[model samples]
Target: MTKTNNIEKAYDFGASEFNRKMKRITQERLKRGLPVSLDIPNDATPEELEELKAFDAWTRDGQPVED
Candidate 1:
């Protein structure tokens, strides 16, 4: 499987963990809107890229992709 596929599967397998992390992120964002967006590092892995892509696509519809 591709790295993106694997990461997507792992995300499904770890749904609870994902929810917890997102909840924390949302609460933090609500409490303190950032003045500047943080940049992702240059050497990020394929999986990291896929995660960000999935977040962007999914958050709008409140849906998770099927693994």
Candidate 2:
């Protein structure tokens, strides 16, 4: 497979795994009657998009911790 194809696959897997974990955590927090929060922007600037892309790359590399 091409490099681009491999990158896409890695990003997809990372995103899916992230979503699954987030959903589980949210559910558990709700069951406990605790507040859970997410900071998803409705509109993103070019810099923000670039930063997000970098974060995805980090996640793809198996380093999902946010700084």
- Candidate 1 whole-model C-alpha lDDT, 0 to 1: 0.48
Question: What are the per-residue Cα lDDT tens digits for candidate 1 across 1-67?
Answer: 1244345343442255664456455445545864323346699887777666555333333333332
lDDT, each prediction: 0.48, 0.51
* Best candidate, TM-score: 2
For residue 6, model 2's alpha carbon misses the true position, in angstroms, by: 34
- Tell me each candidate's TM-score: 0.35, 0.39
lDDT of 2 by residue, 1-67 (tens): 1134345322333355676565556556666888866564769886565555554444334333332
Best by lDDT: 2
